[model samples]
Target: MRFSAGFSRAAAIAGLVGFGVLIWAAVISPARDWATSNKVALQTSRVEAARLDASIQRLEQEKAALGIETEFSDIWQARQIGEATAKVQAELGEIARAEGISLRSIAPLQSPDIPFAQAVAFRVEAEATLDRVVALTSAVEFHSPVLIIDRASLRRLTRPGRISPQPTLLMQLEIMAPVFIGEGEP
Candidate 1:
């Protein structure tokens, strides 16, 4: 009987160990796999969210720039070729006056043979100190009304009569600008 009791106790311990292993295989193993896959998916989602946020920011910046371009287009559309040229001339005159430079002439280049709707060219002559000339030219190039400098030349002016307050240089400029033709004309 004593030997039988010892054998039964051993059997009970073995059965308990086997049942624990079966429970781990059936439930714990699958739970662990699911937890690991869920963690991986969460990480991927976080990375995707960051990328989308960056794209949104870039699009917002582009939209703001487009707004500025649209405003400039509206201003351009409101004026005709002659009005645009006159506006540019006025702006240049203001720049010259501000820089204390003498604007000699602002005249349209004769393009009788070519269609007037295509382009309008201007020949501008000015005399100013070197620094003032540089400032005026920079302003013309950067300011609106979109003037393209086709040709630019500069020469030192020599005056033999008397002592001038400041040395001056002569600048000759030829600039071309696209003319806006009304829909009715062409």
Candidate 2:
């Protein structure tokens, strides 16, 4: 009976050990592994979220700093040629007044294709001496008219011996420039 009791006690301990190993394999180990995987996944998602948040913050900062109501790409096209021509005319008039040169003609050429945005050609003939003509040409380039002065040729016309209003110095000038746009499209 004593030997049997000892054997029974040993058997009970062995059974308990096996049951403990089964529990570790079936529940504890798998649960721990599952928890570890979830932690890694959560960490990855947090990092991604942080990156997205950083991008959004950068865009917001740019918007605030620049005070931009519209993106550059969204802006409409075409140029305002008439307003530019008028501006150029005013500037040319001022130049003529300052240089003591009377413009014979301020003809505007509206062509479909010209080097400038508006393709404007000004047939400006003036009754001025050679020196005044040179000064006027230089002044036109610098003034608000912003004429490119692509081509310029000065000719001394044959002045009749009698008093006539014909200009002794004739200037043919060509200018090409890009026009600006405003609230309205051209």
Best by lDDT: 1
Per-residue lDDT tens digits for candidate 2, residues 61-146, read 98896785533332212346576667666666777889998777777765436431334445666767777877887876765424
Collision count of model 1: 0
Q: Against the true structure, candidate 1 has what lDDT?
A: 0.74
Off by over 4 Å in 1: 1-75, 111-118, 161-167, 182-186
Q: How high a TM-score does candidate 2 get?
A: 0.45
lDDT of 1 by residue, 1-186 (tens): 999999998899888888889989999999999999999999999999999999999999988876673333312222467766676567667877887887899888853233324466778898877888788788767656566677899998997885767677899988766555554532
Error of 2 at 129 (Å): 0.6
